[model samples]
Target: MTARRADRAGRALAQGLALALALAVVSPACAAEADPANDYPTEARADYVFACMAANGQTREALHKCACSQDVLATILPYDKYVEAETVLSMRQGVGLTANVFRNAARFDDVVADLRRAQAEAEIRCF
Candidate 1:
C-alpha cells in the first residue's frame, strides 16, 4: 500500500510538471495575440525605451516613464508606421545635402508629423 501511494504521488508530480510546461508554452502565444504591439519586435521596443530615456534623462523614474511612453506609442501607432516615422526623423537630422531629401519630402514630413502627434499624446498620457 505504501509503494502504491508513492507511485501515485510521483504520477501527480509528473502531471503537475507537464501542466506547468504546457502553460509556459501556451501563455506567451495567448499573450501575444492579446497584446497590441504584437507586431513590434522586442528589439524595437528596447531601442525606443533607450532613446526615450536618453531624451528624457536617465533615471529610475525615466525608465518607467519611457516604458509608458513606448506603450502609449505602440497602442496608437502600428509598428510599420512607427518605424517609417523614426526613419524619417533620423534621416531629417542628418548633416548633408543628401539629407535634404528626407528633410523636404512631404510624405516623410507627414509620417513624422503623425509620430509627433502620437508622441505628444503619449507625453500627456504617460509623462
Candidate 2:
C-alpha cells in the first residue's frame, strides 16, 4: 500500500510539471494574438520613430514621445491599412500622371484620411 501511494504521488507530480510546461509554451503565443498592435513589424515602428525624431528633434524626450506615438498609431491602425495609406502618399509625391491618379482618386483620399486621423490621434496622445 505504501509503494502504491508513492507511485501515485510521482505520477501527480509529473502531470503537474507537464501542465506547467504546456502553459509556458502557449502563453507568449496567446499574448501576441491578443495584442492588436503586435501585427506591426519592428522595423516599421523603428522607421516611424526615426522620422518622428527627425521632425521633433533628436533628443531623449523626442525618442520617448516618438516611440509612444508609434505605439498609439499601431493601436489605432492595422498594419495593412497603414501600408496602403503610405503607398498612396508615396505615389502622390511623384511628379507625373501616375501621381495625379493617386492624388485625385476619392478611394485614395479615404485611405489617406484614415491614416491622417490615426496620426492626429497619436499626436494628441503622445505629444
**Which parts of model 1 are misplaced by more than 4 Å?**
93-98
lDDT of candidate 1 over 44-120, digit per residue (tens): 99998999999989998999999998888888999999999988888878889979999987988899989999999
lDDT of 2 by residue, 1-127 (tens): 6999999999999999999999999986787699988778889999999999999999999999999999999999999999999999999999999999999999999999999999999999999
Cα lDDT of all candidates, in order? 0.90, 0.95
RMSD of each: 2.6, 4.9
Per-residue lDDT for 57 in model 2? 100
TM-score quality measure for candidate 1 = 0.77
Q: After superposition, how far is residue 74 of candidate 2 from its true place, in Å?
A: 0.5
Top-TM-score candidate index: 1
